[model samples]
Target: MIVVLIGYMASGKSTIGIILAKKLGYNFIDLDEYIEEKEKLKVKDIFTLKGEIYFRKKEAQYLNEILNEENRIVLSLGGGTPCYGNNLDHILNQTGVISIYLKAQIHTLVNRLKNEKSKRPLLAELENGDAVTEYIGKHLFERSHFYNQANITISTDNKAQNEIVEELVLALF
Candidate 1:
């Protein structure tokens, strides 16, 4: 089974994905890192150098490749992966692939992302926590539709990593 963890920035997809993979005894892949490796450019660099349109096209291509080839894997996707093109449809239609959304509240996301904005291209421009909070609130509102399309949705608010993994494991089996 390929378990794809999807959620917005700072939603703990990568962190929880590692724990979930360990629990399930599956290999883990972070899709952003995968793209960075393949393109020899960081996601921010890709966006800055080639533009978002190019990045999205390549993102879709790589996502398709990974979904087609991998099995028994825990894949953590970038926040915007599902909202572009037919990527969500691909994940939903694929056999033996379970798409899980790591749902987090706006306040949760703001709190988490405020400190890590430097690492996230999308959030890097915000000047303060309040601004970050407002941005995330609006972003999450827009992205929820795509995220809610996941086969399974797990709330990560006020949840410990292991506890969330336990919940995900329960949901999967």
Candidate 2:
């Protein structure tokens, strides 16, 4: 089964994915890392050198390739994966694939993203706290439609990793 985790940046998809995979004995694959290794560049570098269109195409290809595998695994998708293409539909059609949205409040998201903003190209460009808040709000408004299409949505606002993991385990399987 492919348990795909999706949400806005810093919503804890990767973090919760690792815990869920470990608890369920499933392999965990962060799609961004996979793309980095394949393209031989950091994700930010890919966005810089090749452009977002190129990166999105590669990401779709990687997602298609991984969907063919038979192993039970959890995949953490990039924030924009579902919003931009046919990726979400492709995922929905595959058997044994359950989509989980790690939904977080805007304030919580801003706080979580503050420290790690440098690593994320999109968030790195925001000028100030208000910018960050507005950025998240606008993007979340745009992506929430696709995100809400997930089979299960877990609120990660102020929640501990283990607690979220427990909720996922009970709700998913």
Candidate 3:
């Protein structure tokens, strides 16, 4: 089975995904990192250089490639993965794949993402913690419709990694 973890930035998809994969003895792949490796550029650099349109096309291509080719993978997706161009439908319709959304409150997301803005190209332009929080609130509101399509939704607010993974495991079974 392929377990696809999807959520907005700093929602712990990658963090908890690694743990879940380890415990399940599945291969772990962070889609952004996979793109960076394949494109030979950091995701930020890709956006700065080739632009988001190019990046999104490649992202969809790579996502399809991985889904068709891999098994027993815990795949951590970029925040916008599901919202783009039929991607969510692709994941949902694919055989042997289960999509999980890591749901976090706006405040929880703000706390986790505020300090990490520099790492996120989309959030890099925001000027303050308040800005980050605001952006996340609006963005999450827009994206929730896409995210809510997940087979399982797990809240990560105030939860440790192991706790989240435990919930995921139970949800899976």
**Per-prediction TM-score to the true structure, in the order listed:** 0.98, 0.98, 0.99
lDDT of 1: 0.94
- Write candidate 3's Cα lDDT for 1-173 as tens digits: 99999999999999999999999999999999999999999999999999999999999999999999999999999999999998999999999999999999999998888778889999999999888888999999999999999999999999889999999999998
Model 3 off-target regions past 4 Å? none
| lDDT agreement with native, every candidate | 0.94, 0.92, 0.96
Better of 1 and 3 by lDDT: 3
Candidate 1: count of backbone clashes, pairs at least 3 residues apart or interchain: 0
**RMSD of every prediction:** 0.8, 0.8, 0.6
- Estimate, for each residue in 22-97, the C-alpha lDDT of model 2 and write its tens digit: 9999999999999999999999999999999999999999988888864689999999988877999988888889
Clashes within 3 Å, all models in order: 0, 0, 0
Give the winner by TM-score: 3
Q: After superposition, how far is residue 60 of candidate 2 from its true place, in Å?
A: 0.5
TM-score for candidate 3, residues paired by index: 0.99
27: Cα error in model 3, Å = 0.3
True lDDT of residue 66, candidate 3: 95
